[model samples]
Target chain A: MASSISTVPHRAGLGHRLWQSRIDYLFLVPGMVIFGLFILYPLFASQWFSLLNWSGFDANQAFVGFANYAELLQDKYFWDAFARSFIFTLSTVPAQMAVSLVFAIILNNKLLRMSALFRTLIFLPVVTPVAIIGIVMTIMLSPFNGPVNIGLLDAGLINRAIDFLGDPNLVLWTLAGIFVWKWVGVTMVYWLAALQTVPAELYEAAKLDGVKGWQVTFFIVLPMITPFAIVIALISAIGALNVFPLIQSMTQGGPYFASEVMEVYIFRNAFATLNGAVPRLGYASAAGVFFGLAIMVLTILQIFAVRYLRSREKPNGA
Target chain B: MALEAASSAASEYVIRQPLITPRVRRWIVSALLAAVCCIWIYPLVWMVSASFKTNAAIFASEGLIPSQPVFDNYLRAWNEANIGAYFFNTLFVTVGSVLLVTIATAMMGYVLGRRKFLGRGFIFGLLVFTMFVPQGYTIIPVFELLSMLGLGQSLWGVMLATTGGSFVIFVLLFAGYFSQMPDELEEAAKMDGVGFVRTFWYVMLPLSKPIIVTVIVMQTLYAWNDFLLPLVVTLANPAIRTLSVGVYAFKGENFVDWGGMTAASTITIVPVVVLFLFLQRYFIDGLAGAVKG
Candidate 1:
């Protein structure tokens, strides 16, 4: 679309046309400058830094070509962190999408009352900082003394307080649960917006044909919102891959690094001394580059996959 | 006779299905929704209630209400924990970043959406591509850049970093908005001999109030809640730390000060929630616009 727009021919001389469009360039100056200086520069620079051996502090840097990348490939902890990150993404994205879809569908009902209040309340968590949620949840879900355990124990649902953060097996899943709880509302909002786009006339027609609720939702509503579902899934997947502050504040990838995701792994290596290890900026950069490229590839693939599905479905539906 | 007939008709309309009536269905749905709302809101309510309770009471009691609420926690969190300083620092960065983003993105969106120019597609595509790059990937070089600029460990440095990244959403929102606007207004301004920049300034910009508000609200929530950039950039400086970082530090410092910690959490979160409640219509609409566009 933008290419076509830019391809429009002008009868005027090239210099004159360029002069006429100078204002457009003027408007783009600040955005382009900032993007170049901050976003673009850092992006490519990280790739270069990945190939060099440099402590983030020292000016005396060693140019070790591909050594950092090679180390990352052999590093067990890096691969473990990558696998954990992948697991986190897989676990949270689908669960968050499902829960958000359910909430959105419920709230979309015309018979539902006080929907705005429910939505506002649900979305409250999204506005709260993840770090704060981590801290509060850490205390709220603390074993032996936390309210969640206390409530469960008092109700006789459990005999003992569950070690939500301390137990290695439970910690990652627990973080995923908290993440879903916090972010489901944003996805709900997205689904709600998509739901509104499904014309009411279609529902009326379906009802007139004596189509039941679940069938109508399955055949009509879901298909109508499939594009939105794809976008939401993509965004949620990327977001889950970037999980950091919550883990940092809550567990710091503790209990033997069970909850450590890619971002926390990168942060710990690049900035902080962890477990008697000095900061490894180069190694962290390599990990970041690898993870980033993986995400980019995944995103591109998902985009194409969604487009193909949409095109295939177009024959039978609008 | 007419009243009796109307009453009888109303009774006829109230006839129910065999399994469940419409009224019963509505009641069931409402009850279920209420239950879900309660579950969703429980943690926030717990946070607020626990903020007023003693540390022992917070752990001992599972109730939403405190046995004997006090203001001491808030007082301590505000005065001793230096939450007030963090609040100001967060406010400064959020405001600065929002202002910069709103202005820059609005102008960029205007040009990209309205003007036919060279490399427009390339610029827009680049922005879109950056959206997929995980934020953490950029942190290393961004830190290095800030250090080179001598802005590291400062709130302004954090703001610069915050404003630097993928604001493509705002640009997309504004562009989608501006494109939909009829060209007649700009054409009229052109006929009146208004220059392109002036036309955007005097006419298009004034008409962009809704999108502007949307960008401001969304960006405010983003900058205010952001943790990673501030944490990284201001790692060496505790004095300029944002609320999120402050609360995280407080947890480490006073491990057992649950009341003070919750109080600090509530303090940081409440303002955003309140702001959201007031401007939710614009916020939701803006978000929908961004997604749909």
Candidate 2:
């Protein structure tokens, strides 16, 4: 049954339709107000703010049209941080998707005992606050008497203690590894949901056919779940970009700016006055707007991709 | 007779061999998974252990068991670091935001999902459009807005801004759920002469338990763990900091106080962990629902 007033005939004008469902329109007011105030307004205001020379400290502000954006274009540090954000995403998203896909497969096994317990264990970190995880990891990965370093040394895997967060060369990779650990559960949950879409009857048929486990997985299950990978990858890439809290808590983009991602860069420019440099809210806003535009483009691309996939799948009635 | 018996025994041996291999393989997989799970949660376990240790002991040992346990770190984090107050702040903000989002989204989703009225597509399109807009960059304007409204240094501002996220995902979840509800329920409510608001309050809201729980679980984790918003909002007022911001601030101040840091971390983490443990099913369902939406 179509409850929508859209079922009304074309003869019913827009005014009549709206009058028929005035209460429905009223229901939307609160959400719309909040959205306008918080999201829509901020969205435009940020673009406007990017054009000014404001320190975010006082009212002594001046309008500087596109100056911040100009500086951003030439700013080596901004470019490096932007590249580093991509680097973090490139490194972590694949690793997280691959690893979590494996866990999802394992837990999806009916023969596996206590799969719920294992799933819960892997997911515990996801529920735990990232700020807390970063702090705990700092201590847990400390070079001296840290659990991870000690375990590595005892196993003869390393000749000396490794500074996971301190060494500039290793810090970004280290953060990437921790990023995988902290967020793997989320990707795993996605995989688990995708895995559920695979029909049980297909697995049963494979068993009856005497299909080898590996062969069945590669031939049957993989193809069935392949469609979900694109969406899952997109989600993961978005999540990977949001490593601000984790990085902030763990190292604050330290060790001589080796691990500074875009978020850290934006934050430092906007709020932090480090090394006698003044905080530049306008510059940071410009950087943010630039990054936001890039994300918007990516999202548009995603929309097109999703539309293409859906169109392709529709002929197969999938 | 001897030949027949030997042939039967060989068949039985073949059957036993395959069975034994699978059983052993299962044992191996279980053992491996168990080990990995232990290593996965080791940091959390270590955090708890380190919280009980003195700074010297924490530095001297890598063991999961503390060499000498002490309550000083807890006391220090609670009193000196003000984690106790932050705990209350986090609770207040989390509950307020959850309630706000829940009520607002329920109303919006109920209307959008069930009643296709004028401007519905426009509103819905706007919601979906904003979802693509990266939220991290929008903080400056939100901060400015709050400051202009004189909520710059208050927990109330934190609550409002935190609730004011482009929660299109949650709204979609609610919309999807409401759309699936039986039409007869609303039909019956209308027959009883129930008004629009009363129908939602009395029928739709209660019937949408799964969606409500999903929204609450996800929003609680978000509001509880949200660092950036709380950090920026409460930057001017130390007294109103949430656990996340407070813990970060505590870490910054006591860089060398590993013991105290761990204690603060433990304090910040325990409640949510406990909440997850109790509502683990709901959390998984919520996540799955979110992905599906």
Candidate 3:
């Protein structure tokens, strides 16, 4: 996109000496100061601690060289969490991408009335806090007298009530389904916004070539919106990594750690104070640093992969 | 592909397409979509309906609308539950964080967007890098840092913990507006010995409204609904709990109150929902900004 639009900036600055220019960046101090104090500082500070053996307090801390990272590597729970998070990202992202894409196509049909109202309703769950979502899902999916189970029972769908969150065997997939429902609409909004930008003329041309319906969707619409698709995928990936509150409220990583993602595992060990003491700050910090690095690597790889694939495409070739 | 599908569908239909006209098809699709939409929204409707019902009526009225909608649940949520106090606390914290994020990110964004300073590219990359840093990965250090800074177990700690948000800084990459903005008004103001601060206040601030509004809306929503921050840092102090935290407080160790929970949840979300209804246009526009990679 940048290469395609490269040239002169429409809002030209005077090409005078850099020092002599009137564009003084000194005006940006107050905001920078806040970001520096709160955000930028904490990250580097965390990295510095990742190399130390401090239990989150400075008084009796020791600078243990890579001991935290070494311990993290050997920790069984850490690897379990990493694997669960990968499974979560795998199960949720592609399903959400597919459903959200269908929603976008339906909304963009132009002839549909009440689409705006439907879009707004679909987007309601996006702004609802994850904590509440957890409570609502837990109650609704409860085995006895909960509306969901009752509806299924009345329909003769099941002989006995199912523990959606309590059964370890069926828990992760159940959580995945709820996660998809909550976010699929959010992703649909992104898709709808991106879809509007795809010009109508391309569709008419495709129709003239005897292309319509699913053929037009696959051949014409999909390729045109690949850039937007890549963006939504990255957003979904980042979102899955932070799936904390919903799990914490509903299950608390119960059913023998079957659904524990990295976020919850870190919180449980680092902040919960559940076993009658302060959470393991140093070890948890190491886990956090490890996960952060992994995310950074994944994001960079995704960007590179998308760019290379996009470049390999011969304009519109399949 | 077209021939395969078209021929199959045509041969499969036994009535030879003697059935529905386009008008009937349109109405049928609309009605079907409406039913699905209802199914989609049933959870939300059920929640609201349950919130208005008495304890027995909630379980009894499960099949349809509440038989006799009562206001006691809402009253209990408002007064006894203290959701009102939590709402105020949440609004204050969220507004404070959003202001801090916007002012800080905008100033930094401006410098990175408009200035040719030292390590400009490095700073820009660093800011972008922060976007991928999740709380799951940052909370351990953050919990330590907040306590070390004497802000833990307080509302202020919650405010400070969200400072590194990258959503604000990313807005700076689209500095086309700054490069495009006419300097005549600022030049005239500066010619009168108006310093950078005064010039920014009287001139530059007015012009950066679009992006500023976007930052405000996005940050406000995040701060309003944020649970993990308050949950982690302010657990010891119920007084410091935000609306999100207050809603979770209704969950007891022995049992959960579904009616009270939904009542609290409804109360908690009303403010954000009201804000969304009011700023529907600006909210979408702000969200569109986040969508731009």
Candidate 4:
């Protein structure tokens, strides 16, 4: 049916063809307007905002040519936040992918009954609000009387309650663990979908070859789902870098800026005053532009990397 | 008779040998996964249980079941935090944004998917590229844009802001669905002398139920759970705050009211969880399609 429709001649002129498809243009109008205004415009407009010295409240703003960028280059707090953000991303993405892959592999087993129930239970956190998760975790991980501390003491793992969110050394890792807990379900689902696409014949053939379970998983399953693995990694990395409300609700980047990440840093500078520091809208905009461009570059690199990997694999009959 | 019985037992042993290992292994794995699932959902279960417990019980007991359940937390959370007002506000924004996004993206998706129009690829590419851009970085400008348009501090502004942020996801889902749809129905409508808009409104729109549901479910969760946008845009007006922002404020104001706070948090997550439970399949499929797209 599609072939027949495509084979029909379009003998009309270009202008006439466009005119005939006026309804299509009309269909696109509203989405385009909103997308252009809210999303696309912000991509460039934020860069413009980054160049100015404005408090985000005053009307008279100084036209500082690259001054914010210059200041951003020398700012230690900005770089510290950036490093912390990278750490959060690095820690969570791998942990999430690893745990989720295991879950996906187990759940993919044909003989696993009540799989639906397990999947729903695991995914419950994903649907819950991040702020709420943060709040709950804050309570659950409280140093003195939190359930986690109580459980640890009861289990004889520790004699004293450790301040999970209070200690500078432990805050970031705790936050990363919490992030993995919430988001592993999402990555697991992605892996499950990817796992289903792997041919049954391959697994059967491997079994016929006397391949062990771990070997089959590592050699056949892992390589087969590499594309999805890479995509999941990139998505999680990007998401982790943008962690905000979780930090806000839980720590507010407290304990001497130990848990501070790029988004929270930007939020602090742009809107809220934290620890007696004044709001720096211009500096935050500059930092935002920097991080935004960094993400764009990372995405482009990922696209290239994926294409390159696919190209390399195609010769081997991928 | 002894020899015959021995042979039958030997045969049964061989058959069981081949099957017993994997069946046992499968059960072990299922049991392990069930344990992991409990750990994963423990926080949420704990939260719900704690919402019912008295403050003393919440701190003292680490168990799932409450020793003595009380309804006071919910009452205080509802009254003190003005949760009812915030719930209504969240519902209003979520519904408005979901409806607007569904219609707008459906129309856009139809064009981009089914038609070979000028600049379609370019516009689609632009939209896809915007997906990678960190939206958190742009909140300041978005806040300014909303204020400039005089929609700031209003639920309508929050709705509109949320609409375009993830607009690409719905568009991709809808476009993928529409592209795969058979063209014969639309062609038949054309043969009957129906106009293009009529064909879309009557034929294509009606046929887009699945994709529409996916979009609605996904967007509803997003708009309902969203915090940062509403946080920034509704800063001036406390009356227009959504559940998330209101709950955050509740925490800030009553720093020690963990009971009430947990109660409010429970209230905030219930609607999304209920909707997800009802539309579980669509939610999973939509998420898969979104990531793949």
Write down the TM-score of every candidate.
Answer: 0.93, 0.93, 0.86, 0.92
Report backbone clashes per prediction.
0, 0, 2, 0
Model 3: per-residue lDDT, tens digit, A1-318? Answer: 132123434444545333433344454566566556656666677787777765555675778878988988998888998888889889999999998888777665544567667777777777677777887788889886788888888899997888888899888888888888888876886786676555555655555565545666677667777778887888888777777877887888878888888888887776674657765666777788888888888888887898788778756654
Q: Please give, for residues B101-180, the per-residue lDDT of candidate 4 as tens digits.
A: 99999999988888886687898888767777666688888888888888877888998899975688678778887888
DockQ of each: 0.41, 0.37, 0.32, 0.36
| Docking class of predicted structure 3 | acceptable
Task: For residues B1-293, write the lDDT of model 2, one tens digit per residue.
Answer: 35323433322222223345755766777889999999998888888998999998877774678766799999999999999999999999999999989888888898888887778888888887777555568788888899999998899899998887537777888888888888899889989999878999988899888788878888888898888888888877899999988988888888899999999889888888888888877767767766665
Candidate 3 has a TM-score of 0.86
lDDT per residue as tens, model 4, A107-205: 766446687788888889988988899888988899868888888999999999999999999999999999889888888888877876666666656
Model 1, C-alpha of B235: deviation from truth (Å): 1.7
Kindly report which residue stretches of model 1 are placed more than 4 angstroms away from their true locations once superposed. Answer: A1-17, A314-318, B1-19
For residues A199-259, write the lDDT of model 1, one tens digit per residue. 6567666766767667777898798888788778877876786688788889988889888
- CAPRI-wise, candidate 4 is acceptable
* Model 3 score (lDDT): 0.71
Each candidate's fnat, in order? 0.55, 0.57, 0.40, 0.52
Model 3 chain A weakest 10-residue run by lDDT: A1-10
Q: Candidate 4 — which residues are off by over 4 angstroms?
A: A1-17, A204-215, A275-278, A315-318, B1-20, B291-293
Model 1 achieves a DockQ score of 0.41
DockQ of 4: 0.36
Global lDDT for candidate 1? Answer: 0.83
Off by over 4 Å in 3: A1-25, A52-57, A208-210, A313-318, B1-25, B166-210, B289-293
Model 2 segments beyond 4 Å from truth? A1-3, A316-318, B1-21
* Model 3 residue A95 CA deviation in Å: 1.3
What is candidate 1's CA lDDT for residue A232? 80
